[model samples]
Target chain A: DAGITQSPRHKVTETGTPVTLRCHQTENHRYMYWYRQDPGHGLRLIHYSYGVKDTDKGEVSDGYSVSRSKTEDFLLTLESATSSQTSVYFCAISEKDPQETQYFGPGTRLLVL
Target chain B: SQQGEEDPQALSIQEGENATMNCSYKTSINNLQWYRQNSGRGLVHLILIRSNEREKHSGRLRVTLDTSKKSSSLLITASRAADTASYFCATVVSNFGNEKLTFGTGTRLTIIP
Candidate 1:
């Protein structure tokens, strides 16, 4: 609905392998976020970007990293993926305004074997 | 740690019934928002109630916020089969620049025909 799309809708990889998920938005929103959803864990923030080249860590940023070199694309990479990182990842974008509602992408499901 | 906790981890209701879910948070919030996820898909923004607002409504959805109790509730009137999904509540804390949202574990709703 927000012109947001996440690449690699589903993936299964062996442990210790590196994986990168991409989120692209046509809306050119100023804020972008990456979150992971797991059983009994709800949705936890991994990383977020306020603008291009400006990013910050979140609650679960241990094994994940994010980059936003441009306004339209935000990338999440799991360096040496682990089994604990197996979950559904969602990307969201919102305006700079604090009261603006966030729009989410379709999500990517990753399984680490 | 999770910022918000939703009550009634799972709910079952008939198609014409009303479904209600409650969320409680620990810290002060600037606003509270609701989101819905359809199975394996991404989450969709449903409604948002600002700290200054007491109640808000959209279509068949009604949201009420009580900052004094640090809690919020979502009510879906005349819920349909399509409304069956996982509902989550997110809170925006009173921080400066980035308004990072923390989401609840979610309440799974099953609509019986």
Candidate 2:
């Protein structure tokens, strides 16, 4: 409902394979964030971008990387997929402050075998 | 470790009854927000309560924050069948302009229709 869409709503890949998930927003928000949701572990932030080409790591950024080359597109990449990386990934956008309410996309379900 | 922990992983109630969910955190926070997520879908922002504010109301939703106890609660009155979903509470902590949000595992609410 926020004009945000995540590509490849469902994906299954083998371990050690490279996988990239894309988040596109039409709101032209300045802040974009990536999070992963797992059972019993809640949602953990993977990475976020404040502006074009500006990014930062989050609490669970161990095996994930993000890039925001443009205002509307934010990409999350897993250089090598692992079984532990299997989870539902969500992308969120905020107009300005990180402390404000965020709008989320539909989310992508990834499975690593 | 700053993640909020929501009580009662799952709850079931009648459609017209009220549902209350509690969240507790371990650190000082700048603000707290509640979100709702339908199965296999993304999260939607519900309400927000700042640390300095004791309570805030939005429609049928009421959010209360107690900084002294490091806890927050969400109350939804006159629940509807469509209100059945997983509710999450996220905490925002800031340190030197770097703010981080940690989400709880979420409480799954089912309204008996």
Candidate 3:
């Protein structure tokens, strides 16, 4: 384990409802990221934070928003859940290094019903 | 998307057989990484190969990067049934603490015992 934990490991929600996934890391890494994994799309980045209060959008940031209030917690929120938004959400952290090798959490599986 | 494309979307082999998965990307990258994901879990980083390096080995895993061809290959020797999982190749482009990784659809490897 990379000292990372995701809340609500499995979730089922209806359409148009809001959902939030939380990622917490104790490694005190400077980089944290959120990604969604689907059948054919592989893992697409949604958002990332370089440090507390510093964040950026990733390639597939649509329908997703993220916030990092502190160094250890990164939150991903879906304003309104949709069937298309159902995916396995992963949180990864990497130390400040050249390679940027990410260590991932156990993941949270979201199902939009 | 400039994401890596993995060949042989699915592979099946008996235990003890070697497996090779190839990935080809469309653009220049600073580094390439391999990840493995088991059912109902998050992805685990396997290895990383820099653009400047040609080959690297980690135990039974071997990774080769050929920047000239924009390609990389992962070789697993003496595979076991426990090794069955999905393998992905992610390419990292750009730096400056805002790194983005493009991932391939992935190869589903089934090691039959």
Query: Largest lDDT belongs to which candidate?
Result: 2
Residues B1-113 of candidate 1 have per-residue lDDT tens digits of 77899988999999999999999999999999999999878889999899999999999999999999999999999999999999999999977765778899999999999
Name the better of 2 and 3 by TM-score. 2
Candidate 2, A21-112: lDDT as tens digits: 99999999999999999998889999999999999999899999888889999999999999999999999999998889999999999999
Q: For candidate 3, write residues A1-113 as lDDT tens digits.
A: 67999998999999999999999999999999999988889988899888899988988899999999999999999999999998999999989952568999999999999
User: Rank order by lDDT, top first?
Assistant: 2, 1, 3
Candidate 2 is scored at a TM of 0.98
For residues A26-81, could you state the per-residue lDDT of candidate 1 as single tens digits?
A: 99799899999889999888998889999999889999989999999999999999
Question: For model 2, which pairs clash?
Answer: none
The global Cα lDDT (0 to 1) of model 2 is 0.94
> What TM-score would each prediction reach against the true structure?
0.96, 0.98, 0.96
Who is ahead in DockQ, 1 or 3? 1
Looking at model 3 chain B, which ten-residue stretch has the lowest summed lDDT? B93-102
Top TM-score prediction, candidate number: 2
Write down the RMSD of all candidates, one decimal each: 1.2, 0.8, 1.4
Listed per prediction, chain B TM-scores read 0.97, 0.97, 0.95
Every candidate's DockQ is: 0.71, 0.88, 0.68
